[model samples]
Target chain A: MVPISYYLILAAVLFSIGVLSFLLKRNVVTVFMSIELMLNAVNLTFVAFAHRWQAVSPQAVSGQIFVFFVMVVAAAEAAVGLAIIISIFRTRQTLNIDQINLMKN
Target chain B: MQLALFIIFAALAVAGALNFLLQRHPINSALSLVVVMLSLAVLYWSLGAEFLAAAQVIVYSGAVMVLFVFVVMLLNAGEEERTTGSRAAYFAGIPGAAAVFCLLSFVFLSESKTLGSSNLGGYLNDGTVNIVEISKILFTRLLLPFEVTSILILVAILGAVVLARKEPDPKVVTSSTDAAGVIVIKEKV
Candidate 1:
C-alpha cells in the first residue's frame, strides 16, 4: 500500500512544475498547457483523497465525481481558450506572452 | 507490485512534465503534456478510479490534446525565442514554486498518519463495480452539475466558432463598395 501522502506529494510536485512553467514560459500556448497540468495535478489529489476515504464511506466517490466536473470544465476551457489564443495570434502574429501588451500603454 | 507500478508511472509523469517545461517548441510541449496525461491516467487506474482513468485518457489525452496540436499546427507556431525575461519572474517564480512545493510536502507529510494509505484497486474488493457506483451517484446526486456541463460545452463550441472565424477583410469590403460606386456612376453617365 502506498501512503496517501505519496500521492499528495506527487501532486504537489506536478503542480509546482506547472506553476514554474506558467511563470517562466513565454509562449501563451505552453502557459495554457501548464494551467492544464496544474488542473491535472489537482485532479490527482482529489482522486487520492477519494481513495483514502473510500474505506470510510461510500459517498467518498464524490471526489471522483468532482474530477468528472473538473474534466468537463477543462474541456470547455481548452476549447474557448485555444480559440482565444487563435484570435490573439491572428491579430498579433506572435505567441509570446511578453509581446502581447496592447493594453499596457 | 502496486508500489512499483505507482513509482514507475509517477516517474514517467514527472519526467513528462519536466520535458514539457524544457521543450522549445509548443508542439513538443503539447506532446509532453499528452504523456503526462496518459501516465496520470494510469495512476488514476491504480487509485481505483476506473471511470476517471478512462475519462482522463479519452477526454484529456485524446480530445484536449488533439485540440492543442491542431492549434499548434494551424498557427504554425515556431520555436520559442530565448529572452532574458523579466528580472522579477526569474527572481520570484522559481522560489515561489519551490516554496509552494515545500509547504505542501510539509503539510502532507505531517498529516500522513491521519490520511492513511491506499492499495491499488483497493475499492474493487467492495463488490460494487466502479462505474456503476459512480454513475449511481453522478445521475442522482450530481445530475445538476452534469446538466450544467452540457450547457458549458455548448457555450464553448459557440465561443470557439465565433472567436476563431476570420474577420471580414476591411480592404475587400471597401473595394466592393468602390466597384459598386463606379457602376452607379457609369450608369448615370
Candidate 2:
C-alpha cells in the first residue's frame, strides 16, 4: 500500500504549481484554470486523509464532506466567473489581465 | 497495483496542468482543466472517497467545466500572444514552486516510514457515508463557513448576470451597407 505521505506530498506539489500558474498567467482563462488546479489539489489532500483514516468514524467522513463543499463552491464559482469573463471579452476583445487595469500607477 | 495507480494519476494530473498552463486558447485550456478534474476524481475514488469522487466528476467535470467551455464559446475569445511577465516574476515563480516541492518532499520523506506503522483500525467497506450525518455536522458545526460559501456563490451568480446582461443598442452596428451585408448579418444572427 502506498503511504499517506505520498498523497499529501502530491497534493502540496500540485497546489504549488497552481499557485505559480495563477500568479504568472495574465490571461483570465488561464488564471481560472490555475484556480481549478488549486481546487483539485485540495481535493487530493481530502481524499488522502479520508483513506488514511478509513475507520468509519467522523474523521473518515470529514474529508469527504469537505470535498463535497469544495465541489459546490467550484460549481458556483465557475458559473459566475465564466459569465464575467465572457462580458469582459465582449467589451474589451481581450482577456489579458494586465491590460484590464482600471487602477494603476 | 496502488503504486501503478498513483503513477498514472500523477502523470495525468501533471500533463493536464501543463496543458492548462501552456495553451494559448481559452477553450483548449478549459478542456485541459476538465481532464485534470477527471483525473482527480479517479484519484478520489482510489482513496476510498467514493461519494467525493462522484461529486468531483458530476459537479466539477460535468457542470463547472461545461460552464467554462460554454462561456468561452459565447465570448469567442481568440488566442493572444502569451504574457511573459517580468524577469523578476519568472525568477520568483520558479524558485517559489521549487521551494514548495522541496518542503513537501521533506515532509514526505520524514513521514513515509511512519505512515503504515500505525494501522487506522479498519477500512470502510460498503464505501458509503451518510450525507445526512455529514450535513448535520456541517450545518451545526460549520454553519459560519457554510453560510459564507452560499453568500459567495450567490454574489458570483448575481455578478455574472449583471455583467453579461446586455441591452442591445441599434447604434452598435450601422444600417446595412449592401445586400451582402444584410445577408451576412442574417446568417450570423
Candidate 3:
C-alpha cells in the first residue's frame, strides 16, 4: 500500500513545477503547456483522493467523474487556446510573449 | 510492489515535467509533456482509475498533444531565445511556487493519518468492472454534465475553426491612362 499523502505530495510538486514553467517560460505555447501540466497535477490529486475514499465507500467515485469533466474542459480549452495562439502568431509573426504587446500601447 | 510502482512513475512524471521546463524548443517541450501524460496515465491505473487511465492516454497524450504539436509545426515555432527575464518572476514567482508546494505538502503530511493508504487495483478486487462502475454514475447521476460537455466541445470546435481561418488578402488596384485619355483601373485579388 502506498500512502495517499505521498501521491498528494507528488501532485503538489508537479503543480509547482507547472507554475514555475508558466511564469518563467517566454513562449506562449510553453506557457499554455504549463497550464495543461497544472491541470494534470490537479487531476492526479483528485484521483488520489478518490482512491483514498474508495477504501471506505465503494460508490464514492465522484472524484474520478470530476476528473473526467476536467479533462473535457481541458480539451476544449486547448482547442480554443491554440486557435487563438495561431491567430496571434499570424498577426504578430513572433511567438515571444514579450514582443506581442499590442494591448499595452 | 504498489509503493515501488508509485515511486517510479512519480519520479518519471516529475522528471518529464522538469524536462518540459528546461527544453528550449516547443516540440521538445511538447514531447516531454507527452511523457508526463503517459506516466500520469500509469499512475491513474495504479490508483484504479482504469477508464481515466485509458482516457488520459487517448485524449490527453493522443488528441491534445497532437494538436499542440500540429500548432507548433504549423507556426514553425523555433527555439526560445534566452532573455534576462523579469526580475519579479525570478525573485518572486520561483519562491512563490516553492512556498505553495511546501504548504500543500505540509497540509497533506499533517493529515496523512486520515488519508490512509491505497492498494494497487484496490477498487478492482470486488469483481466489478471499472468502466461499468464509472458509466453507471456518468450516465445516470452525471448525465446532465456529460451532455453539457458535448455542447462545450462543439462550441470549442466552432470557435477554433473561426479563429484560425486565414484572413482574405486585400485587393490591390492600379490606375492607368489609356490612349483615349480615360482612366482605367485594374484590380488584383
Extract clashing residue pairs from model 1: none
* lDDT (CA) per prediction: 0.91, 0.74, 0.94
The regions of model 1 sitting more than 4 angstroms off are B171-189
Q: Write the per-residue lDDT of candidate 3 for residues B52-165, one digit (tens) a residue.
A: 999999999999999999999999999998876577999999989999999999999999999989888856676786788889999998899899999999999999999999
Error of 1 at B11 (Å): 0.6
Model 3, residue B49: what's the lDDT?
A: 94
Candidate numbers, best lDDT first, in rank order: 3, 1, 2
Residues B1-189, candidate 2, lDDT per residue (tens digit)? 777787798788878887777777888888888888888877777776666777888888887778778776776767856666457768888798889888878977797876552122225445534455567778898889888888888887888788778857644433455756653333233
Off by over 4 Å in 3: B171-189
Please identify which of the two predictions, 2 or 3, would achieve the higher lDDT against the true structure: 3
Place model 2 in a CAPRI quality band.
Answer: medium
True contacts reproduced, candidate 3: 0.83
* Candidate 2: share of reference interface contacts reproduced: 0.63
Candidate 2: list runs displaced more than 4 Å: A55-59, B117-122, B126-152, B167-189
lDDT of 1 by residue, B3-97 (tens): 89989999999999999999999999999999999999999999999999999999999999999999999999999988866778889989999
